[model samples]
Target: MDTHLKMIDFDFEKLRPIGLTQVVVNSLGAMQDTTPPGSRLMRIVETQRDWFTLHDGDAEHRARIAQRLVNVLQMQDSTVTVGDWAVVTEGGADDLWIAALLAPVTQIARRANDGRRQSLASNVDTALLTMGLDDDFNPRRVERYIAMVRAGDVAPVVVLTKSDIARDAQERIAMLRERLPASVPIVAVNGMSEHARTELMPWLHQGQTLVLLGSSGAGKSTLTNTLTGAFTQDTGGVRRGDGRGMHTTTARSMHLCPQGACIIDTPGLRTWRPDADGAALAAAFDDIETLARQCQFRDCRHQGEPGCAVQQHIAPDRLMNFRKLMRDAERSEQTPLERIAIRKKWKSLHKAGAVRARDKRR
Candidate 1:
C-alpha cells in the first residue's frame, strides 16, 4: 500500500485487514479516517444528529464508519469503544485481527467475561473544562469535571466562555482563582472575538490532546467551530432567560487543529458524576488539605474545634468553600460502604478531639 501524504486522504488498501489507524472526527454519526504517513489526526470537529463533520485534512467529511467500529468492537470488548487515537502498526493490527477472529464477535461482553478494559481515547494530555459566563457557570460543576479528568490521569484547564457578556468578568475570574489550584490555567474567552483565538493558541500546539466538557448551551460547540475556523457544527440558540442552548452537540468526536493539537469535544452533560475516589478531589483541593494539616486533630472537621488551625489561618469564606467541597465529595462518593466508612472515621476523630477539649477546660 502506498503511504498517503495527508491524514484524511488514506488509500483504502493501506488500511490493514485487522483495523485502520484513524481518529474519531465525528462520534455521533461514526465518521473516521485513516492517517497517512505524514499527516496527523485531531479530535472532535462537529456533531449533528447521527452524522458529524470531521476535519481530516483541510476538508471536513461526514461519515459514520468510526461509530460503527466502536459499536462492533465494544460488543466484543467494551473498552474497545470510541475516543482514542492509534498509530496503526503491523503487530497491533495482527492482535486486533485475532480479537476480531473470534466467532460471533460481540461489541460488549458480559460482566462475567474476562477482565478487559476499553478506553475512550488514548494519548490524551489535557481535558479543557469549558463553562459559559452566562447562567451555566457553576463552581460545583467545574469541580465535578476536574474530578473526572483527574481520574482519567489527564490534566484539567478551566476555560470560561462568553466573557464578553459578563459584566464582572474580573470578579468571576478572581473567585475561580481563589477556589481552584494555582497550577491550573483559567482562561476567559469570547468565542466571537479574535482575542479568544489568541488566548487559546498556545495550548493548541502539536502533540497535545484536549477534551472540551461542559453543560449544553455553554458554547462548547461554538468554541470547537471557532478553533477549526469554520461552521463545522450546527449552532443552537440559547434560551434568552436562562442562557442555556438546546443541546446542539450530541456525540463525542476528535479533530486535529491546524497547529497539530488534538481536541475531543463531547456532548453537553446534564449531570456529571465523578466515578472516582476522594483522592482526586483531594488533589483538586490541595489548599484544603494544607489547612486540615494545621488542625488540632488529625481529622478535624473545621466546624468549631477549639484549636482548629484551619479556622485560624484560612479566611472564613475560604473555609466555608472548603467545607462545601468536602460535603460535595461525600455526596459524590460512589459506594455506600465507602461513604459509611468515611463518615465513621471522621465522626470518631471529631468526637475524640471534642472530649479532649472538654477535659482540658475542666
Candidate 2:
C-alpha cells in the first residue's frame, strides 16, 4: 500500500452538486488530503448487495468496494450505505473501486428485528417522514419515526400525504400538533400534485440532503418524484382493504432535485426500531425526559409512581408509548445472558400466579 497519494489535477467544485459541504469537507481532513492515487471523490447514490452507484457530480458510475476497504468495514461493524461519500479509483475498464469511505456528518439508522443495526442513509440534513392521512396514519408510529430520525441528530418533518382525500385532515393535523413537539413541523400535502414541492421547499435548500422515510403507502416515492420534478421513483397505490400502500421502491436511491438538493427515497419500513440507547431515546423524547426529572423518586419509571410528573402532564398514550420504547431500548442494550435472566424472572412470576390460582380452585 502506498503511504503517499499521487497528486492529480482535481476540481473541488464537482463535489458540491452531490452535497459536498464545508462540514463534510472538513471531516475529510487527512482522508481527502491523502486520497489514493488515480482516485476521485464521489457520493454514493444507490446501494445494492455488492455494488454501489456513485455520483461524481457530473455522472453516475457503478462501483464495488475494494477488498481492503471491505475488510476494514467488517472490522468496524459497518457498511457503505447510500448518501456516503467515498474516494474511488478507476480499477480497470468498466471497473470502479471504492478505496476509502469518508465519515458522514449524520447517519439515519434503525434496529432490525434480528437485532442488527441497519444503516439507512448517511450525511442527511433532514428526514421527511411521510405518513398517509388515511388508514396508514398512526401518531404512535409517527413518534417512533421521529425518535429514529432525531436519534441520529437529523431534523424530522412530518409529511402527511393523501390529505385531499382524508376528510378529517385538519382534525388529524391538530391532534398531531398537540401531541408532538412544537419544533417539529407537520405539513399536509397531496403527493400527486406539484404543490408538494412548494410546501416542502424550506427543507430542500441548495446542497441540502433529505431522506424520505415511512411505511409503504405513505407516499414517499410519490413525494420523491414530485420534489425531483421527475418520475424518478415508482409509486404504488394502497390496498383498499387496509390502505397499506404497495411497496413500489425496493431499494434506497438518491435523486438530484432541480433545486440543487438531493433526495434519497427509501423503501417503506414495515418495522422501525430505533437503533439507540436509553440516553439517545430520552433525548428524542425530551418532553417526557424533562418531566421525569421532576418525579419524586430519582428512578421513577413513570408507571403510576407517586409524584410522577410525567403521568401528570403527558398524555396517557404518549406516556405508555414512551415507556414501551424505553423498555425496548433497555432490552436491546442488555447482554444475551441478562436478557435470558429477565425472561426467567417474568416466567417465574407468571408460574407463581398460576400456582396460586390452582390452589384457590382446589
Q: lDDT tens digits, residues 171-200, model 2?
A: 998999999998899999999898998999
In terms of lDDT, model 1 sits at: 0.59
Show the lowest summed lDDT stretch of 10 residues, model 1.
Answer: 97-106
Q: What lDDT does the true structure give each of the candidates?
A: 0.59, 0.86
Residue-pair clashes per candidate: 23, 1
The best candidate by TM-score is: 2
lDDT of 1 by residue, 113-154 (tens): 122342334445677789987788787678657756766677
TM-scores for every candidate against the unseen true structure: 0.64, 0.93
With a 3 Å backbone cut-off (N, CA, C), the pairs that clash in candidate 2 are 217-245
Give the 10-residue window scoring lowest on summed lDDT in candidate 2: 1-10
